[model samples]
Target chain A: MSEEKKIIICRCNDVTLEEIEALIDQGITDIETIKRLLRIGMGPCQGRTCLPMVISIIARKTGKSPDEIKLPATRIPVRPVPAGVLVGEIDEE
Target chain B: MKNRAEVIVIGGGSTGTSIAYHLAKLGVDVVLVEKGYLGSGSTFRCATGIRQQFTDEANIKLMRYNVERWKKLSEELEYDVNFKQTGYLFLATTEEEVEAFKENIKLHNKFGVPTRLITPEEAKEIVPPLNADEFLAGQWNPTDGKANPFKTVFAFARKAKELGAEIYEYTEITGIIVENKEIKGVKTNRGTIKADVVVNAANAWAPILNEMAGLDREFIPIKPFKHQLVKTEPLKEGQIEPLVCPPAWNDSYVLQDGEDGGVLCGTGLEYGPTYDMTPTYEFLREVLKWATRIIPALKYAHIIRQWAGFYAKTPDSNPAIGKINYIDGFYIAAGFSGHGFMMAPGVGEAMAELIVKGKSHVPLDWEWYDPHRFERGELRSTAFQIG
Candidate 1:
């Protein structure tokens, strides 16, 4: 309920625009590097909403084509799963 | 006697503006109208991938001609469309797909498209990061390319306007005035304009527009199918190069805007029939999952945004590109499904030729793409990956 507009650049990891900008300012402008450093678009939602916005900002500042940007890796089941299921303990013999 | 045109082309996408330009170039008085902003509909929604690899002779011919035009689009239109010849890699991951690609390549080579059947190693050389563990081969057409859909549409509209053609924005065509099997004019939300010819170039809403003319519902079976695209932040210098189209793993395609360096990616999801424009969470999930699995390097590529657009499906995947059956001066340029952008330049010119000179010089068998082909049980399965 925070009235602040959370610039959720990565719906998967709930990364914010401010965080991405800070990383870019720190000379970590590469999308892959940023993902490795901050785990931004690595979550289940992937970089769906945030990918283009970040690309636009970078392109505006650096004058690059969105095509030059490397596409994010796709995972299986492409959808999200329940945390309970992910953490379920298996029977030990 | 005032503020009238001989032909009023509806919809402001590439098809409409291009038709208007060709007509005006042929000294035909033309007026182009749009309900929304120009290039905002399917044109902007397009991934802008253009290629010349099809399973048919006529389509290959049309796309080949379009590629020729795209080469000099900037010079002809006097504006830069940002046309990039980064080549297209249609990856095949199965034996069946490889068999299909053989036929496609045969047709392409027959029509001088220069598509070659390459081994997975060749595809890996081009893409480098492709998951080549399981795939037969792919069709690589180096002359195939991508472009800026928005800029191209704007360039067409600007050129059309310069040639004594009137373009009205924010104007909606509510009804078409047809009497005695002839088009009289169109009734817009603003006012009525009389015209001798009315071309329905509205992409997704083409069926509804045809209904407005009181045409038969079976005149064109154009249905809407939604697809999603996502983009990532700019990559480091040499991670990936050029646009990628994988026919094996999924119905997914990838392209990077050279100007922005952001990776624009899309996939034809298994979406059933629906006109809703809402971007679903499911779409995001599937697109990202495939992007990661196919190119493992994109595992961390931050997704910037996602969007959805509709494809107007015809009984055949090819569009209904000519005149309506009995309605004089009522033509159709819709039902491109998802491949409209690639064919826009050539289609516009062909439609213009049909409108002005009664025939097109592109040498396409007009009978196959005709709107009347459906009723004659001459249905064509030209489109296979219709997501």
Candidate 2:
């Protein structure tokens, strides 16, 4: 079976392993840290895929618990809503 | 009959408003001019995800400062920004991806951002509904969360106004008048206003403004890319927790929006040739597919709505900040891609510090984001890429 064709994280930006490792070597060690460092997992998807992988890497390198690392935050419109919808609904609440 | 301010700002988006707020707090006579309502630009259209995990110290420090301010934004401004620390999670599916996460976690720790790497199992523990078999590893930061972008922007603007700053909305800036290598003032629809300095916080429109000032800044080959997000009917029970998926593998993210009851969801829509912000059937299908794969429960929810916005992209996927070398009293806080909202306050504080104290305490190197860097061919690549 094609090894289940692993899911590549950071898809919106096409960030690969080599690039991420280079960032680490350059001194990035946390997912949140790498986020600001490399802008990983901050895309429109908001770290949904690459975040898991980012956590594993940080855990292995830093020897700190993954639970300790904070996750990247999530914002509203969970799905994209049109500007009109946002604007028109101003009085909905 | 009016007092000529020492500094004038253009664009009332998060960057401009925050910069005005910070400068006003420092007792600077600043006027913020916005062509439209505040936060009407990238601020309102942002994903509002503030993160500290970074490969560089400057970014880490910038986010660290912003995150700190976000936590206290409501209290400081006496307006609830609804800043929520919903926590963020990043998942990696390959060895190559895992390596990058490792390095980033270390850097965050060094910089004092509480970030940690987690196992797929542990990741599932935090976000109980995730499909653990889908990824190799993940990263987590509990303090990372989202806030109301509109209220956040308003909060800053209101505070700045109260502190003696004049914010002019519905006023468009036509150009920056530079005389003898120094800023003369800015030309707007309302007329010309003289000032010693001008900062461009126009977000996606920054390049045009930069060109107006005769400064050469690529400001990230930003094309207004459209993205889609959906909100479901309010959940009957606690069926969801706020969570973000690593964009590397998943196209969608699922999170809860506090007592608002609806589950907020978003995804990087597959790229299309045009910069159109219109919604498409293709995006809806893609979002449903990924949302189901990551969080199977999403299958039960009904998507109540959808919307679109633009991200100011860069060639290297990073932001262009700081002052222009060729122009005196000209600065930038643009090209944030989509991270502008989360990074707005910090960008504001940095610009304010630079403006008031003539330097930043966090040492954001002016050279890295120098408008001339692209000309010198000294551009660096970035790892984060999303729609």
Candidate 3:
């Protein structure tokens, strides 16, 4: 029987480890550039699920500390909210 | 470490990359520095609508040249930009809007833009899903369309690199080294780069860069506003036609993505100046209400994702593109408001010409878009600004 393909990274955008490795092989070293090229951390979750994994991958491949591999800029509203809530249409639960 | 370049452009969005490409093509040693990835700013979040329809002649003429350039962009850049001239349909709901469109079409025709005021039935014929009864008339322009922003920016970046331009990613410009009102160089997080000329194409973050050079007061009129857009699940191709816009309906617009069949929709929410790019549920509810009302079929479409971006809005809703007279080698190409992506090509070509040849090859009144216009109380406003 054939082995099942493991889905380990970027489940929101369906970016796998193999794809990330391929981009790294092509001389893309920056985490932000990789995110833009592969749309890995750009899904609705906004990199929450896969950013740490991507940082580790880059650190390992580049032989640098994870701290040296800077993460992408994080903007406000850390949590995704419905449009209504953003516009002050708060529901009293 | 220290580096030297003739010109340093401080942004990696479409405008900055295009400027770098044009400058490199002109044989100028240019380096483009991006704090983030290319197109990670407003370029990636744009609705990608490229239209020539405008109320003012200057804007129409600029867009006319831009549209022409967009048509041959793929060939010039040696990359497929996926520019589809699917047409733009501007619906008029009231008699007042119809009258306004009549004048708009007249101006459009004067500038050689092939736009015509069509009846409600003709509008339906173009976009079958449109509710014809909701509109009185619509102005349709066949040449207006959408392009893939990611491909377009990469095309410019690749071409620029091919033409001997250096691009530095993950490089942040922390300060501008200015002395006696002359640009010396830019201090970056990576290292200080000595540059005689500097172009501020930072878009939403233009104010910060301008402030670093002590030119913040001149750029005070430029502000940032957050706009949200939602994408629905991919549907059958040809289910929708043309970018349908109801300007009278709070500046709401809808279009189907060319690469993916997802229906993209958004509206001009009355959000104040903010750096927050949070997608609001109010925007989703409002956009869907207006979208489904226009195309009833959209009611069944489920929103897969929503995102927000900042528009570097100017007081006049027009861009500030020209050399700053007070500063010798500092050029401003920042205040594009919401239409930077559409206007990037023209602005790039003009800025390159001005920098290399000391004047634009195009017959644009460069003084009209001067960065110092706000200080002089001279503002040229555009009428057809949608969210």
Candidate 4:
């Protein structure tokens, strides 16, 4: 189970459990702050891949429930949309 | 932490970083603080449309100067900003809009913008995929272009740092210390920095910073509206000619990104003032509805991502620049209403001149953008504002 400490949590941004622990050691407890510092959830998936893992990591590190730690603000287009589709290009069936 | 700087510019977005770069170039001890990483605010999410096609003479002139600077920006910053002068095409569907565009073209021409009112046929020549039947006339400016916002902000920040300006990211400004209406310093979560000059280039958060300075009622409130934009998968290079804007179609505009060839698009739909950066499914539907009609080829492209950013809007869409009379050395370079990213270079140059020489060397009428304009009821609004 010691290997889990070095396991990658955010595959999109290449964030790992050890990296999150390093940031938490620097007094960065908030999920949003941790996200900003480590780019934990700012990747293509917009935290979908790593947010749950990060919340659990934070919860375990600070000895608190995952519900106690506030979730980061959810922003637009929930899924990754191509740049071309943004201007007018829609996927034609 | 050095704990002191001659000038503390809050918010390390396009505006703040530009100001810091310019001030540092002029040998001012400037310190820039950002709550998040650089360009993490509206800068990262901006549509990156750079245009000089404005109805008002002031805005036209301001953007004209900005576009000129943009032309040489990459060379000056020693970075490829991906500035493509693909031109901005404004399609006028109604006769009234066409007539309004003719007047705007005249104003643009007077300011050396080189904008011309072209026939529908000519518009199609510029953008081959444009549906000529949809519009009566088109206002085309060949010089107006788009820049890579991320690269541009980093270029400025890098140059500023190289010139001895200190930038602190992940630092949130909590309070402003003003003694007897004179500028003293600012209190950040990190520590209090004693600064004689403080410029609130915080965009959407400018009003809160203003309130912290004890000048709550002095400046007009800058409300932030969630402006959403979507990017499609990379298309073939040179497939689209320029930024195709159909103002009549809910102010929707589309352009191909020069760096990645992705079709970047947005609309001017008013979502009111909110901090919600969540992109709505409705926005995607609405933007596509008009966009597909304008360029039928776009219907085949797949949307890759959608994101929302804030447009710090004032009562008048124009930004508030210059120092307030009440607060000594407390300056403002915000409230751009989505145009801040495009006007960053011009605003940075002008603000630096104002700070160093006590007046703007640029020909722009800085008084029109004074923070007290709302109180004096001298609000000057621009007619053409693309989302």
Ranking by DockQ: 4, 3, 1, 2
Best by DockQ: 4
- Please write out the lDDT profile of model 1 over residues B1-387, one tens digit for every residue: 224789999988878888888888888889998887776567776777787777777777888898998999989999888887778778887788888888888888888989889998988888777776656797889898877776787778778878888888778989999999899999888899998799999988888889999977667888888777776756653334556767655677676665455676777684646787667777766766666666765655655566677777776778888888688999989888777888888888888889888998866568878887877778886665522
Count of clashing residue pairs in every prediction: 37, 85, 6, 19
Error of 2 at A45 (Å): 25
**Model 3 lDDT per residue over B5-118, tens place:** 999999999999999999999999999999978988789888888888977877888889999899999899998888989999999989999999999898899889989999
Off by over 4 Å in 4: A1-93
lDDT of 2 at B59: 70
DockQ of every candidate: 0.04, 0.02, 0.15, 0.21
lDDT of 2 by residue, B14-42 (tens): 78899999999989989999875676666
Off by over 4 Å in 3: A1-24, A29-93, B218-220
User: What local lDDT score does residue B163 receive in model 4, on the 0 to 100 scale?
Assistant: 98
* DockQ computed for model 3 against the true two-chain complex using alpha carbons: 0.15
Better of 1 and 2 by lDDT: 1
Off by over 4 Å in 1: A1-93, B236-239
| Candidate 2 global lDDT | 0.71
